[model samples]
Target chain A: MQKTASITIRRKFRVGNLVFHVLVIAFALFMIYPLLWMLTSSFKPGTEIFKSASFLPETWTLESYTYGWEGISGYSFGVFLGNSLFVVALVMVGNVFTCSLTAFAFAKIRFPLSSFWFAIMLGTLMLPFHARLIPQYIIYNDLGWVNTYIPLVLPKFFATEGFFVFMMTQYMRGLPREMDEASRIDGCGFFMHYWRIILPLTVPSIITTCIFSFIWTWNDFFSQMIYLSKIETYTVALALRQYVDAMGNSYWGALFAMSIVSLMPLLFIFIGFQRFLMDGVTMGSIKG
Target chain B: MNGKRREACAGYLFMTPWLLGLFGFTLIPMLISLYYSFTDFDLLTPETWIGISNYVKMFADKKFVGSLGVTFKFVFIGVPLQLAFALLLAVLFKKERRGIRLYRAAYYLPSLFGSSIAVAILWRRIFNKTGLVNQVLALLGIQGQNWIASPGTALNTLIVLQVWQFGASMVIFLASLKQIPTDYYEAATLDGAGKLRQFFSITLPLLTPMVFFNIVMQFINAFQSFTPAYIVSSGTGGPLNSTMFYSLYLYIKGFGEFQMGYASAMAWVLLLIIAAFTGLIFGTSKNWVHYD
Candidate 1:
């Protein structure tokens, strides 16, 4: 009788588990339905896109991809992609170098008024970008740099992103001071100590900073919109906006195709570095 | 120099780039933006000191007030709804079940792309009259309009987009949820408490701090939400300005129309508004936020 009772409980447990799975999966499917719909609809010919609610394309075609790649106004979409990658690369390098340099100081050096400055840095993290945006634009416009990528890339070199500096500082604080002492004993000066010893050890933080900077820069539209005007200089974000505004809904298939192409790099990064992304998000919240 | 002074000097040297950036970009510009708020500084024309005229004009301007209302509505409605979805889903997914990681990734994927222009474009098309939403509506014998193009449903579409990306907040909530000691749950279970009861008495109390954090961060974020409104509205914030998000409006005024002084006033007000909300949350959080 006890065995029968145990069997009955096991059966009930299985039923509950099945229900949980079904519910969880159903919700997940709903969450991603829009995205999947877009992906499938991109393959459908323009006329077929609105004909069915189904995710599967009645007849898949490469027409949209080819057409979107040709781009509008005589510039290819490849130019936009290249421009985006270029900006992301520079921004990544600048943020890493500048944030690390600043972070190393905040983390290790006991500078006079360092805490005061560090506090101010943390304050900037909470600050809305709108606070300085107007003035920054004015300044950039004064420099004759309004329509160039300079406005987008240059500020990053000065470690304008306080979040990374704080993140790297938090990471550097946990690293052993023995490494610093050893470097000092080895007669390494300040530059050597930071460049050779601390930086190599802060690889994880560096990676996190790079991933974030890359994503943020690539996805950045506000500054891109403000600064870039010419078709030749447009990043993916800017060009995509221009494409939609210029083309309207007349070319829905090509629009979706272009949208997918734009998301591909971010998609790869998400798939590959998802764990790091989660770590970055949690680290900011938990520590702050 | 003495060793301590020398070390301090080195520290300053290391911080030079950030210090330069702080002064050149954040600090001085914020000061200038504040200064500009008092003047009629349209880029094409000479900036003249106007003595709070811009601020006064902002209050009187119909479009300015409308945009502010839209922004407030978006912030107040979108954030709380998103947080509720976040906490609910976070709690549901907190269990260490089979394929949990994959589920988490799948859920988190939308958020990673949530604020991007690409997804914003997808949002624009997906809610079109002949888009997927309408296609699905027809299956139920229900007709659908272009949700984004209609003032009534336009802002709601943006809100749904906000809620759809609840995974970002869920990640934060999930992290905190995971940090809650299992021993607490074990103790509750020993006292004959079921999962639902333990969740309320133990879980909810422990989750308060996270709730506060997510609300503040997400509110700030949602308030500044631009790309979706810009893309969905085609940067006009239109269909009778139903989706005129503050930043979008500010962008149009400042950059589009060269209303620098007025937009600067709007920008300063934006800062105050964000600060006020943050302060409000921080003030109230003392009562309910549990800390050990």
Candidate 2:
């Protein structure tokens, strides 16, 4: 009797576990369904999108991708993609060099008013961008940098993006200050110590900053839209929007195709560095 | 010749970029916005000085009031609901079950692409008149309204979209949960505490810091929510202005209408509102937030 009851309990447990696994799998599918739909719709013929309910394209073609790249917008996406790449690359370099330098000082250097300045920096994090948008626009206009990428890329050189600064500072704080002291004892000046010793040791934090700045600059629409008015200067995001705005009825397939193409690079970068992204975000939030 | 003097100069030099940007981009603009609030400046021409008239106009403006109301509704309802969903999912995924990594990844994917224009466009498609949601309703023998086009349901649809990306907060909460001592729960179980009881007694208390963090973050983020509304409503605050969020209205005033001075005033007002709301949260946090 005991043996029979034990067998029944074990069977029930197995059934329960199976049910749990099935539910998890279904939830995963639901989360991924939109991306899948976007991918499939991108390949489908324009008419097939509205006609078919299947997740897979009945007749796949590269027409949409090619058309999306060159046809819909008078300006080819190559220009926009290049512009975006230039801006992102500049911002990445600026963020790594400047944000890390500032973060190093805040973390290792002992100075009067250091804590006070740190508090002030954290306080600035609460300042909403909208509050400063009008003023920024006027300044950029006065500088005649409105149509250029200067306004977008220049801010990073100043360590104005507070989130990156704060993340780098926290990571630096976790490291031993003995490294700085030892470097100093070795007759290295602050700049040399920063350049040779601190920079190399903080590769993880530097990568974190680079990844964030790249993704942010890549996906940034509002500032880019506000700054770059001419079609020649437009990023892929602005170009994509124009396509939708112009050909409202027949271009949904092309728009989806371009979106898939635009998002792939960012998606790849994110997944490739998922660990750093997760750690960076977790560290930033925990300290707050 | 003094070390102190050299160090001070070095510190200033290190902070030069930030100071320049802060003064040029942040501080000067902030001050300029304050000045512009009292003027009627268009970008094409010089400023025309006006007094409290802009503030008065804002108070009397029906659209402004409507947008504020819409924003308020979003903040009050959306923030709590999003945080709750995030916490629930965090707890569910916190256990050491098999295949939990897949669940974690699935839950986090939405937030990974949360603010992307592509996701926003997808949201519009999902809630369209004859979209996937309506198709599902049809399967249930129920008729679905034109969710994005109808005035009654448009803003609510955006709210639902905002709530859907609760993954960021969930990940943070999961991290915080891991920090809680397992011994506390083990000791509680020794006293014959049930799972639910132990959760309230131990988990909730330990998780308060993260709860406060998520609340403040969500509130701030929701207040600045512009992309989803812009994309979903097709940039018109739509169908009957049901989806005109505060930030969207500000954008319309500044960029669409070219009322730079008035928009600056509106921007300052928004900053004040956000500051006041966050201040209130911090003030009340003393009572409930527990730290180890």
Candidate 3:
């Protein structure tokens, strides 16, 4: 009797496990179906896209990609892609330099009102950007910085993004103070300590910052829309948005194809650096 | 003593860029915004200080009031639902299952591009009159509304888009869930506690802090959400203004119409609205949000 009961229990457990996997799989598919549909739809002929909801295309073609690459007016899709890359690259470099340098100060060196300044920095993380948006626009407009990458990439150089600063500070503080002291005892000053010792050790945080800065800057549209008006200077975001006006209902295939092309780089970075992204999420939560 | 002075000097020097940023970008701009809020001006006009007029004008503005209500509904409805989905999936994934890593990765993919223009474009097409949704409905012999064009469903579609990207919150929840001791579940099991009982009595209480964190962060983010709305609504927030989110309206008012001062006033109110809600959540969190 006992042996039979144990067998029954094992069978029940197996069924339960199967059910769990099925449910999880169904939900996961539901979550990702829209994206897959978009992808498959991009390859579909524009006319067939609205004919059926099936995510799979009956006949796939690369014609959309070729046509989409033709771009709007005189600007090719390559120009938009290049513009995005240039802006993203500069923004990432600026964030890495400004955020790390400022965080190092908050973490290592002593100064008057150091704690006060650090608290203020953390406070800025909670403050909404809208509070300063209008005035910042005015300032940028006054300086003739509107319609330039200066308004976008320049802020990163000043550590205007407080989250990165806070993240780096948390990371640097967690590092053993003895490392800094050891470097100092070896006749290294603040710059050398930060450059040769602290910076190398803060690689993980730097990577996290780079990933975030790249994604945010690449995906950014608000400032890009407000500042960039010229067709030549339009980023992928601006160009894609303009495509809606320029393409209207026609060329759905091209629109979808170009959209897919635009997302590829971000998706590539995400797949490659997913571990760092996950770590960054958790770290931010812990600090949150 | 000399070394201390030098260190302090070095620290200040390193902070120069950020200090300039704070004053030049954040702090001083905020002050200027506050001053701007009291005046009236368009792009071409010099600021004419009309005491409290800009603030008063918000009450008379139809779009301002409508957008406020839309935003509130979006935040209160979208955020909680997003958190629910996040928590549910997170709880399910808490156990060590086969292929768990791949599953989680798949689930997390949408949010990576959730706010991007590509998704926005996809979303716009997916809700069109002859779009994928309606086509699918037709296959089942059911009529589907033009989701983005109809006022009632337009906001809901936007809400769905927001809630669809719950992966970030889910990842956070899963992280916290992993940190919970297995012994609690074991102990509950010995007492004949069922899965549902254990979830409520043990898992939930332990998960509140992370829940609170996600809530605050997500709400703050949802309040500032502009990209998806701008893209999905085609920058008009139309279909009877159902998708007129506050930030979009602000952009239209300030930049689109050149009502910079009016936009400044609107921005301050948004700040207050955010601050008040955050404060309310924090104040009430002690009752429900438990932490170790």
Computed on C-alphas against the true complex, the DockQ of each candidate is 0.70, 0.53, 0.70
Error of 1 at A191 (Å): 3.0
Tens digits of lDDT, candidate 1, A1-288:
979988998798898988888888898999898888878878988878777777898899988889889987888999899999999999999999999999999998998898999889977877888889999998899989977889898999999999889988888888898998998889998899999889998897888888888888888898899889888999999988887877766787888898889888988988888878764342643454
Over 4 Å off, model 2 = A1-16, A71-73, A279-285
DockQ class, candidate 2 = medium
lDDT of 3 by residue, A1-288 (tens): 979988998898998988888988998888888788888988998788887777788999988899899998878999999999999999999889998999999989989998998889977877878899888888788889888889888888999888889888888888997898798889998999999999999998888889888888888899899889989999999998988888878788898899999999988987898897654343543544
Off by over 4 Å in 3: A1-11, A279-285
Could you give candidate 2's per-residue lDDT for residues B19-92 as a string of tens digits?
A: 78778777888898989988998888999999977888999999999999999998888888888888888888
TM-scores of chain B alone in all candidate structures, in the order given: 0.96, 0.97, 0.96
Error of 2 at B139 (Å): 3.5
lDDT tens digits, residue span B48-116, model 1: 999999998888988889999999998888889888988898898898888788788888888878888
The lDDT of model 1 is: 0.87
Query: CA lDDT of each candidate?
Result: 0.87, 0.82, 0.87
Model 3 lDDT, residue A281, Cα:
47
Worst 10 residues of 2 chain A by lDDT: A279-288
Q: lDDT by residue for model 2 over A195-248, one digit each (tens)?
A: 898788788888878887887788788889899998898887787777778768
Answer with 1 or 2, whichever has the higher TM-score.
Answer: 1
